[model samples]
Target: MTTAVISDSSSLIMVGKLKRLDLLANLFQQIVIPHRVATEIQAKEDGVASLILAHPLVSIAATTRHELLALLDGTLGHGEAEAIALADEHQMILLVDEKKARKAAKNMGLKIIGLLGVLLLNHRRTHITGQDAILMLEQVKAMGFRVSARLESDFMTRLHNPITHWHSPNTLK
Candidate 1:
């Protein structure tokens, strides 16, 4: 089973874009977020927060001060660092949307994935079509999440010419 531990930013990104969460839940065997991440989402009072709180597959894990301290020296932000630490300590994949957090996780030899990566995985798994993934990306954009031009171009290309094989590096890129 694939286990993922996500930071607050990624959690908010998923919650803010509700459709993506369904796709992620379908793709991963287990989804976990730090308790702080959950609390932040709840404070936002968005539909994404309520949906995650009610989801059967999502789990909320608490953070330890020790783990947080370990990540303090990394390039990740407070929430993201804590999330990466938890994932690394527990031997789970870290789902982070922040570029610095992703890089920090990579430098630390921790597995990572992002919101866009999860959507691509859903498309590759046939859980959602390429067109559907594009539509969801639009939804995420509408929710005010930042997306890069390169990602937009790549997503359009994928939508236009859907890949036949479901390779990890390709789907997650």
Candidate 2:
């Protein structure tokens, strides 16, 4: 069975910076984003805004879980809360980058993945070479994305050894 994925804004922006947002579309059969997330990306002028707005594989989903969104208020951004709520409603995996958002998603019993996880999946699936993944990782760091030291070490190890390392959302920090 295919894993469902709902994306928050950060991951899309990062990948769009690399001009490879298409990878997400290729890696996941479909990616859903809450309207708030789309708005967030637009507000930032992220390059992925066009892709999210126009891509056939991307869906702009509206979150119906207002109560859940209110419950998660302050702990997460509107985009994060809505993404989590949408994922919860559909039993899908969530793609979020912020540490707090990931923590909240984990606590809420949601399956989560981040940018690194997507890269790893692409590498394991042979969609991208190890070198490409490492390059993207470096770009992400350079873009000010906070990857924990442990995750950096793990990614380097995987790049060098071609061994897969699974990232638990908790271990991301």
- Give me the overall lDDT of model 1: 0.66
Roughly what TM-score does model 2 have, to 2 decimal places? 0.89
For model 1, the superposed segments whose C-alpha errors exceed 4 Å read: 4-7, 11-16, 64-70, 73-75, 158-173
The model with the greatest TM-score is 2
Residue-by-residue lDDT tens digits, candidate 1, 120-152: 777766888877877777877786777899867
Clash pairs, candidate 2, are none
What are the lDDT scores of the predictions, listed in order?
A: 0.66, 0.80
Superposed Cα deviation of residue 80, candidate 1 (Å): 1.0
Off by over 4 Å in 2: 1-3, 161-163, 167-173
